[model samples]
Target: MTKSVIQPLETLRLAQYAVPIPCFVCGTDNMFDAEFCTHCSAPLALAHQADNKKVHPRLIAMVGPSAAGKTVYLGMLMDMLSRRPERMQMLARGAFSITLQQTTLAALARCAFPPKTPSEPERWNWVHCQMRRAGKRQTVEMIMPDMAGEALLEEVDHPHTYHLIRCFLEKCTGAMVLIDSIKLREGAREQDFFTMKLLSYLSELTSNDKAGWRKRPIALVLTKADQCRECMNDPAGYARTHAAGLWQHCQERFGRHKFFASGVAGTCAYRESMTEGRVQVPLRIEPHGVIEPFEWLLSELERSGKKS
Candidate 1:
């Protein structure tokens, strides 16, 4: 009779631990089979993709207060870019990366925006894709996370509260700061304070002096500008006139910054639901000024540095 021998359990475990996978966000060592980063809870799929391509992807952060229209803006932007493919094009790197675009489009087709993003880093939809300009050969690998506004505020007020947000912001080279134009137009001091706090927090986090928040490019986007045509006509003037505090802060602290206005909802209606109460629904989809800020940011980092 032939006898079979089994490998030692300790040896098997040792083999499993031999190669360590470092998180792309937090740089924490994880088992090769880990599905999420232990430190920051970022998807391990990003790490695996990075390893497979042997390329470091640039990170951009989209941050704003709760109800700032981050979800709608991001969802609409991705859907438009992926479908239009006129000026610039984006090709998602992995299958998991397209979930945000897919879900957002599906919801929009039903005249509703995507639901609020979950606060958990692992649950959040991360956009991992390559951007290519018209007639350009080399593509830029980028990862953008749609972070929760509440989680971001919590981290800003209390450091390390959201390790994923903090670590992601610390490593991001650019940021899109979304301001609710509807609130600003109505003179909400709370909006001003929230933006001020976020900018100040970023200033402290990246105070390298030589190349910190001051040098990083920021696009102050006034979302929901369709409600007020004046915002779209002249974004800079709108900022200076309405959000004076935020405008002044950017002028003094940041070196490269610009103002933009974007609106995804063509028309809206408030409807009462039995279960969810009052909710706003989009009547139609008409994207405006959505691609300008993104294109400008990419241009600044890639070729043209518009420092104003």
Candidate 2:
């Protein structure tokens, strides 16, 4: 009898079973007990698993220019979810998915922006949230990527940064592209070109099957509406008149797109105090309709799951 030799591939495959792993969302590894991804903190298993068979974990991309209130919006969204039991009851039963929750919450507590040390053009922050919706506990994994506007305008020849954008867009299920409403009002001509370029690039990427991005839902969100007092006074009217052009462009290019407005720090601009070396209160915090777009996206996801 010849001695049996274990193949390298077989050895590698066996290493996978060594650990009793936890769900990426809920941190529960037991099949009957696990309902979410433990490591990443997303729902991977659930009691009503059959109903959600077609439900795939979605990547919600939060895209915006610097200081456009993306970080604040995210912090407030998480804060809102934490306080509203009824709103989050549909999510998994837990305080937070993982340690990341503490970091996010801490950043919010400081009333300052999250860590945004400039190194790369794109940086991602993930938040795992459990909520109750449609009579079932659900897990929502949100991916927030902040890309520098300068980088967006940079030529695609910058291979590393360009590839990062491509990768994020490819995996994204839905996107919230934020535009600074105040900047628009300030006659910032550069923004128009940036927005057009970004949208056009994304459209091209999604249309190309070779690029692996197709059929992704996108929401064009206008941020800092509070600064535009006129628009804040009547959001519906502003969206109809001023925002209509952008909306139409998206419809023509992406086919599936919606327009929305959100304000995280209801103030106009930040003012630094001379003596303190700290920033003075720039504006009042008046968040409005910040959650609606996300809610709509979740509803869309649910509907898609049901149809499937």
Candidate 3:
């Protein structure tokens, strides 16, 4: 004997896939249910959330060289804003957005720095959030990616090496270019040269006079400034003296840019490890100048919006 059961047709699911969704990073069309872009490998969650929320997000680039503290700085910034919530409030959009913040804070609690972001675009941590200032009815949707420094260098050295990065930077409203204050103070010229090249790449990315990078706001942030009092006090002066080449390039190429100094670890020490050789460990967390650069960038964006 055989039993027969009734089945329902799910044609609506097929209809959803019939319409193609464009990737947020590269704008490549993919099936509606696809998790990652086929061409760029960026998470499709960003596109889905943006579409469902009916808001277009502004992109902010947190760019720097390897070990320049991009991960630590961004994680700390997010935590601070969420905890305080008096001046500015940041609410994360999806579960994926919180991964960077969670990992960074977890590592800091253990007195260790978070691992470096991988060079592959698919492994990057992207943050999408809703931000609103106190006493304001308007809210802005923003997207920030914690991209690997080595990958960024590769893209700048050879154009189109990272298509996702190129597309994202071209759409960025503002950028925070971080340089290691300790490296600059120690007379390392590599940091200075890399930053100059990155700035040049941004300026040449677009030729439209109105929408070029020269017209957008940029913040040249000096990370790990706690070790250098001069950098903490006067970032512009420190850049002029130490990173003269970068300072001159910014002056000549970028029309709207400012200098900032930020530090997270109050003190750090080197420790030997059995598994991974020697590593640096933070003694305590004392953040300074963390929010100023971000605030300045937002204000500039708002100012530009009003002018237009």
TM-score of each: 0.93, 0.66, 0.96
Error of 3 at 274 (Å): 2.8
Count of clashing pairs, candidate 3: 0
Residues 1-308, candidate 3: write the lDDT tens digits. 88998888988789988899999888999999898899888899999888887677999999989999999999999988888788898999999889899999999999999998999988899999888877766788889999999999999999998998899999999999999998998999999999999998999999897899999999999999877778988899999999999999989888999999999998998999999899989989999999999988888888887898
Residues 1-308, candidate 1: write the lDDT tens digits. Answer: 97999856676677878899999998999999989999999998999899988666889999999889888888778877788677888888898878888888899899887888877777889899888877877677889988888888889889998889889988988999999999998999777788989999998896577667888889999999878788998998998999899999999999899999999989988899998899989888889999999988887777523342
Q: On a 0 to 100 scale, what is the lDDT of residue 207 in model 3?
A: 80
Q: What is the lDDT of residue 75 in candidate 2?
A: 62
Better lDDT candidate (2, 3): 3
Error of 3 at 140 (Å): 1.7
Ranking by lDDT: 3, 1, 2
Q: Quick one: best TM-score, which candidate?
A: 3
Where model 2 places Cα greater than 4 Å from the true spot, the runs are 1-56, 89-117, 121-124, 130-162, 207-214, 233-245, 267-270, 273-284
**Which pairs of residues collide in model 1?**
none
- Evaluated against the true structure, the overall lDDT of model 3 is 0.92
Model 1 segments more than 4 A misplaced: 1-14, 304-308
